[model samples]
Target: MSDLPSPHDWVKRSAQSLKVERLEAFFSGHAFDAHKHDTYAIGRTLSGVQRFRYRGVSKNSLPGETMILHPDVEHDGHAGSASGFRYQMLYISPALVQQVLHGKPLPFFKDGVSHDPRLSAATAALLNSMEDELDPLEEDDSLYGLVTTLQAVCGYNQAHGTTHDYAAAALAREYIDDCIEQAITLDDLAKCAGRDRWSLSKDFRAYFGTSPHRYMTMRRLDRVKAAVFAGRTLVDASVEAGFFDQSHMTRHFKKAFGISPSRWCLSLGE
Candidate 1:
């Protein structure tokens, strides 16, 4: 941990995408305002004791342990020791977790940092090299593993009441694949699956790690990639995958993939 200024104003910045952020402060005497995020804060503390008030319970995370904060949960963070805290965080979306869980309802972890070693290894693998370029196959595999472990380790124990609901999330996954090429709206999808858009969206993100729209973007990217490999132009491939144009595809392509689509396509030639 870097030496924290004795009396500090805490500031954290997103390193690359909103899906993750890096904290580089020792908020020894400072307190974070209570706020909620749209994504899960799944991460590990690098050093010092990271203290936070979560779901009305106080939990302290230290080195070698993982913390999984559910989305929209009220929480606050500060140092739990004199040396302060440094941690790497991945703001996972519910859809991402759901994808790994094989469309199970987003699992609920205990309201604190965890000592589970499986949690550490699984979450670490994806968020560790946030900036490294990933092959498509690697991205899918890693995300699948991460999501599944998170659900298994962190899932709500009282699933008896909502077992049917969880089943719906599973059915939603099958629904999505069949309708991938269609111009499907949230309302349309919810109606088709007998789910509310909000729940469906949450389930989708928890399982897939991206919004339904972005998931579609990725699916389209996959199709575009195959087309490019078969000697199609970017414009044609984009159109074939239901993208507006090459530029529309490019923006999402880079954000979802961490690289330009052209680069990925060129690599096929190589």
Candidate 2:
């Protein structure tokens, strides 16, 4: 398919969870501006040529190829061919990765695309059907398989000398979850985790793949999304989610998901 019959773009999201967010989307022209996410953006292009810029290099993911974009990496998306692109993406929280890998640094795929059969199979188990809700145990098993496959594909060494305080980071994460609707400071996290602020910040990033503030913001965004999906207005959702206003929440929403809140709601058929 070298040419798209229509130029319309759309996104369809699966059931939302803090551990992962799944979506299938198609775009004919520009898909997204440069943006960064705090979760690993792993996906497979189903048709056409999915193209993006990552690590200062332009890359294309052909049909059935796995694209493993690292957390917090700046990238953008568009169709590499005129047919446009259709794909399914799984945005997994690094905290969940840490649950399986312990305190190790998140697995890295220097090149955004991978051809490993193990990874392809593992991702297919998760992305094969967006319409069906995964059973809780089935979801856990799939995530475990995917994370381990990613580690193997990346050739991560278990003996890398990097040390992370997983306990401290876990404590800090719990505190953030408990206080997500309030202003959170590094000092607050440090006090809760019983670690020094700076060191805890480092540990948090190493274990969670994002800063404390970013994690807190993402959690709040999750709340906003839930509220909006429950029929609350954008302004009300923002306020309830602890953002100053809808515009403030919108900026972070775009930065994290590469789409505005209103656009995202429309994609949900709201």
Question: Top model by TM-score, which number?
Answer: 2
Residue 42 in candidate 1, Cα distance off native in Å = 0.4
lDDT of 1 by residue, 93-126 (tens): 5655554555455677766688888888877776
Model 1 RMSD in Å is 10.4
Per-model RMSD to reference: 10.4, 3.5
Candidate 2: clashing pairs of residues: none
Q: Output the TM-score of candidate 2.
A: 0.92
Q: What is candidate 1's TM-score against the reference?
A: 0.54
Candidate 1 ranges with C-alpha deviation above 4 Å: 1-28, 130-136, 155-270
Off by over 4 Å in 2: 1-7, 15-19, 157-161
Model 2 whole-model lDDT (C-alpha atoms): 0.87
